[model samples]
Target: MNNKTKSILYGTLASSILLGVYFTVLTLVSGWSFTQ
Candidate 1:
């Protein structure tokens, strides 16, 4: 894998993790149950 591909993969992984965390926090704050 080239540097560009590695960088893109890292960026995508980071963004997805951040987005998941944000949504999890939002759900908790909104009192939505995750285990339904």
Candidate 2:
């Protein structure tokens, strides 16, 4: 694989992980708020 392709793949993977974490945190916060 080429360097450019490798970087793109890594960046995409990182972005997906970050988005997943953001959503999970958001849900947790909302759930906690609901319980109050």
Candidate 3:
């Protein structure tokens, strides 16, 4: 793959993982309940 394509793919993957972890932490810290 080209540098531009690889960079874009990596950026997208990193952002998604970061956002997932951010939300998971936020929910745990806030004691969010999904079974309510």
Per-candidate alpha-carbon RMSD to the true structure: 2.6, 4.2, 2.6
Question: Once model 1 is optimally superposed onto the true structure by TM-score, how far is the C-alpha of residue 30 displaced, in angstroms?
Answer: 1.0
Task: Flag clash pairs in model 2.
Answer: none
Model 1 TM-score, 2 decimals? 0.82
Ranking by TM-score: 3, 2, 1
Residue 3, candidate 3: alpha-carbon lDDT:
100
Query: Runs in model 2 with CA error above 4 Å?
Result: 32-36
Those runs of model 3 whose alpha carbons end farther than 4 Å from true positions after fitting are 33-36
Please report how far candidate 3 places residue 9 from its true position, in Å. Answer: 0.1
TM-score of each: 0.82, 0.82, 0.83
Candidate 3 residue 12 C-alpha distance from true site, Å: 0.2
- The weakest ten consecutive residues by lDDT in model 3 span 27-36
Sort order, lDDT high to low: 1, 2, 3
State the displacement of the C-alpha of residue 11, model 2, in Å, after optimal TM-score superposition.
0.2
Top model by lDDT, which number? 1
Model 2 TM-score relative to the real fold:
0.82
